[model samples]
Target: MLRHLAVRTRFFDDYLLHAAADGGCHQVVVPAAGLDTRAFRLNWPPNVACYEIDAPEMMAFRERVLAGQAAEPAVARRVPLAADLRGEWTKALLGAGFDPAERSAWLVEGPLIHLEAAESTRLLGEIGDLAAPGSRLALAHGLDPGEAAGPDSEPGSGPGSEPDGDPAGAPRPPGSAPEEDPAAWLTHHGWRATRHDRAAAATSYGRPPGYLTPRLSYLTAERRPPAVAPAVQGRS
Candidate 1:
C-alpha cells in the first residue's frame, strides 16, 4: 500500500509542480504538508514564494530532517506555518504572509479521507473563499484497492480527459456508496474542474499497470474570473 501511495504521490507532485510553475503564480500553499519537499527539489521561479501548512511537530521533524541535508529551497521564500487545519488555519496562513488578493496555487494531498464529510466540505469552502480568481487547486486521495478496476473502466481516455470520462462520474466498486462528486462540488463553488483517474494518470506518468490502484483520483480546478458587465452607451 505504501508503495502504491508513493507512486501516486510522485505523479501528483509532478503535476502540481508544473501547474504552479506554468501558471506563473507568485504564491503556493501546501496544506497538511507532511514530509514532502518540493520547495527544495523543484526549479521554481526566483520570484515565487511557497508556504507549507502542517502541525508544529511535523514542521519540527521536517526541519530536523533538512538540517542534515545541504539542499536549499529553489524559491525565493519558503515559509512553514504550523497550524491545525481544523481551527483558524486561515488566520495562521495569512499571518505567514499569504495574500488572499493574489492569485495562488493550493495543493491538498493525502488528507481528505481523514476528514469527515462535513469537515471536508468546510475545508473546501475555506479554500474557495481564500482563493482569488485564476487561483488553482489540486486535490488527491488514496482509495480502497481495486475500487476502480471494475468492469466500467473506460479505455482510450488519457489522464487529461475533459468531456467523456470525468472522474466524478466514474463507477465505484460494488457495495461502495458513491462519493460526493468532487468535480461537481467544486463547480458549484465556482471552480472549473477536470479529473484524472488513477489508471490514466499512471499511464501518463509512464508507470506500468499495477503501479497504482484505479481508486486513486486527482482533480485540478481553477477559480473562474468574475464576469464583467457590458458598458451602457450614452444617448447620442
Candidate 2:
C-alpha cells in the first residue's frame, strides 16, 4: 500500500499542494480521501481548514491509525468526515457546520475516473457553488483521445511486461475513465482555468525515463469573482 501510494503522492497530489500555495487559498477539501496525509504534512496557514471526506470504513481506519500514533494534525482544523460522495452528502456536511462562504482550494485526485460525468458535474457544481469568489481547484484529468492519446492508445508500459494484462497488447485504462472531456466540461461549467497537458507532465513528473504514457492531465482553476460593477446601458 505504501509503495503504490507513494508513487501517486509524488506524481499528481504534489501538484495540488503547489496550487494551494501559489493560489493562496484558505480551505481545502479532499474528496474520496483514501489515505492522504496532507492535513499533517502540508504547512497550512493558521486560519485554514483541511477537510477529508471519505467512506465510513476508510474514515474509521484513518481515525484508528491517527489515534494509535497519537497524531494531532498539524493543520489548523483537521476535519475527517465519514460520508459517501455519491449520496446527499451536502446536508450531512453542512449539518456538521461547513460554511458555504468559506473559500477553498481543492484537490480531486484519483476519483474522477471512477465516477460518471453527471456525477462529477454534480460534485463540481456543488463545490463551485459553495466556493467563495476567486477560490481555486486543482484536479488530475485523464484525457479523451486528444492530441495526447488516452489510456486506450495501446502504448507499452515503459518496457515492462504487462503485469496485469497481456504484454503485447494495449495499455490498460486506469479503472473506468470517462471518454467525455471532463476538464473542458468543468471549464464550461464556470471554472476559469488552464491545464498541464500530457507533454508537460511527462517532462516534469516522469522526467528521467518519462511516464509510460502521460494518460493523465492536471488542471487548476479559480472561481470567477462577482462582477466588480454591473454593465450600465448607454455607457458610450
Candidate 3:
C-alpha cells in the first residue's frame, strides 16, 4: 500500500513540475509542505524558486533531516516559510519575496483534506488572487464514495483514518461540506481545469491500474483572465 501511494505521488509531482516549467513559471509554492523533497530531488532550472510553506515545527524538522543528510536543493532558491496555513501564511510568503505580479506554480497536494471546505475554498481564492495571468495550479482532491451520497452517516464522523495517509497524529480540522467536482469548481472560479483519473495516469506511467488504489482526483488548471472587447471603429 505504501509503495502504491509513493508511486502515485511521484507521478503527480513529476507531472506538475513539468507542466509548471512548460508554462514558463519561475516560482513554485508547496503549501503545508511536510517532508517533501521535491526541491532537492527534482531537476529544476537554475532560475526557478521553490517555496515550501509549513508550520515552524515542521520546517525545523525538515531542516534537521536535511542537515543530517547534507542535502542541498537543486533549485536556484529554496525558501521555507514557517507559518500556519489556517492563519496569515500568505503575508509570510510575500515577505519571503513572493511576487504576485509574476507567474507561479501552486501545489496543494496532501493537506486540503485536513482543511474544511470553506477554508479550502478560501485558500484557493488566495492563491488565485496571488497568481498572475497564465499561472498554473495543481491539486489532489480525493473523494470517497460515501461523500457523494449525502452528509456523513454519523455526527462528528469523518473519513477513515488511513494509516499511510497524512502525517501521523496531525490534527484533523472540522468536518466540511461535500466537495464539488474540482474541475467545475475551478472553471466557475476563472480557471480552465483539466481533470485526470488515477488509472489513466498510472497507465501513462507504465504501471497497472492497481498501482493507484483509492483513486485520487488530480487536476491542473491555468488562470484565464477575461478577454477585453475590441473598440468600435465607426467613429473613426
TM-score of each: 0.81, 0.74, 0.79
| Predicted candidate 2 versus true structure: per-residue lDDT over 35-139, tens digit per residue | 888888766656667889999999999999989988878777778999888987777667765677866777887777777866876777777777777677767
RMSD to native for every prediction? 5.0, 8.7, 9.2
Off by over 4 Å in 2: 1-8, 11-14, 18-22, 148-179, 209-212, 226-236
Candidate 1, position 74, lDDT: 85
Task: Look at candidate 1 and give me any clashing residue pairs.
Answer: none
- The residue-level lDDT of candidate 1 at 128 comes to 85
lDDT of 1 by residue, 1-236 (tens): 67567666776677667767687567889989999788888877667889998989998888888887866888889998888888899999998888999989988876677777777877888898999998988887444222446745544334776732245465433223213556666766668877667777766667787665566667778888866899999998
Which lDDT value does model 3 have at 3? 56
**Candidate 1, superposed: residue stretches over 4 Å from native:** 142-152, 155-157, 163-179, 227-236
Clashes of 2: 0
For TM-score, the strongest prediction is 1
In the predicted model 2, the residue pairs found to clash are none
Ranking by lDDT: 1, 3, 2
- lDDT-best of 2 and 3: 3
Reference-based lDDT, residue 190, model 2: 57
